[model samples]
Target: MSGTIHSVSERFDFTGDELAPAYRAAVDAIEAGDLVVMPTDTVYGIAADAFKADAVQRLMDAKGRGRDMPPPVLISVVESLDALATDVPDAGRKLCEEFWPGPLTVICHAQSSLMWDLGETQGTVALRVPDHENTRELLSRTGPLAVSAANTSGKPAALDVYEAEEQLGESVAVYLDGDRVSGGQPSTIVDITGETPRVLRVGALSLDQLRAVAPDLTSDDDPAPDPTDAPEPKPTEDAEPTPTDAAEPKPADAAEPKPADAAEPKPADAEPKPAEDAEPTHEVKPTEEPAEASNKGENNKPDPDVRPAD
Candidate 1:
């Protein structure tokens, strides 16, 4: 089926009497459950009514992709996110506030009540608010649309409407040519199903920019360092000592020595010395000898006197 192509202004003038025919045709085709190729801020995309399961299936068949890879839903306004997603985390809201109307797609838990099937989305939907005025105007009229890159599976994304038309051909009902889009990259996709938001794909929006709004934003390219897998920090000279290190006892050889003068005293009554004999000697015998001698001499003199008298 050879598709019809229409050239339109890059910017939509809502007030002008002359409306863009291409936009009108695209909206009509989407309402009829037909796919339309349009230019987004990032790249060319083929869009369909997200609520139309058959139309979404047809879109997958056209792209030669299976139901496993679901297409992202594109909305005109930020408010449409609430209608499609449920349990919107604070990080998801902040990301929308910072990066909506730009290149950023958020994956969130799908609203259980919504009657729509986006292939094998597994109760989750990826959504984005593109930064193109014409596309936004179309989305405002069409509500939410299931959109994917305008190329077959495994092929490079179509940067221009011509490339999209060349690849998709008659599969798409209407082609709105908004000139060559500076398709630098696609929207960055962040999955908010977990407690921490993780970047499934790195695209136009850098991880740094996303982190500014959601500090916990993570990337598949740069995964968070696991606490268990992290290397134990090596001890440094200036590093603070750990409790185990501080509680260690000192070596036994570091004790102080005792003084030499502090010895014990000896016993008092062990042995006694021999004392001299207590006798006093004198020359008193000379007096007794002199008295004997005097008696003898008197006797001798008396004998001599008797002899003289005779």
Candidate 2:
């Protein structure tokens, strides 16, 4: 019934000690089967008591999400992982030891004995220990809470309380305004229900960082080819140009008639003259140039001296 927003910044000055009143209001709201929007290390989240089925359903309905996409359970301590999840492998344990209380979500087999439903989870539960002190303290008081990003299913997650209010206004019963989240990136989620741990999503924690702890940790997007190491692909038949299309271009039929003109002395299909025939014509022109001087003593007959010169 207490659908009100409390500002931790204005009242508590972000002091962890002064946040008790706001935490109490959130806890009361959850116990009454209502949704509460609170700030986490990553982003603002709308949380409901995991054991309260109606509250969880309201949380899902407010976010426009379905049962197939179940929200994760947030714990105050790492030991709570056993209460919610089972079959925790060594690699999973190592990763939890290294990255717990931060942006890391591990999905494991749910404990069968627990009498609660979180939608169609398929016997698996996603768990996380958020790094924020205020959120963790609230978790310590309220136990495990089914939490999801405060936004419509397809919309961007809210970064602050005001954004959460704008997206999920009346649906949430209590709003804990802790200002904006420091870590903008979502948690890195890993599913350890199988023989090998496979990364379902990459977020704040990188593959390399996870590998440093669990060398065998694998992902569906593993072994990305290094851009520097990848060799440039050789052109194929489809992409490569042929010789005719390359540097040597095909000449047009009428581009230049010089080749045909050079071979034949006349235009069109006329045959070329023999070398001997061309030589006499050139020689007679030179003799005609001295015709005036020779006219006084010589007739139109061949000179006897020219016979040797012929």
Q: Tens digits of per-residue lDDT for model 2 on 49-140? A: 99988888888888888889999999999988888889999899889889989999999999999887899999999999999988898899
Report the lDDT tens digits of candidate 1 across residue range 46-108: 898999988898889889888899999999999888888889888888899889899999999
lDDT of 1 at 56: 91
Q: After aligning candidate 2 to the native by TM-score, how far in Å is the CA of 174 from where it should be?
A: 0.7
Q: Could you tell me the lDDT of residue 243 within candidate 2?
A: 27
What TM-score does structure 1 among the candidates reach? 0.68
* Per-model RMSD to reference: 33.2, 18.1
What's the C-alpha lDDT at position 153 in model 2?
86
lDDT per model, in order?
A: 0.76, 0.78
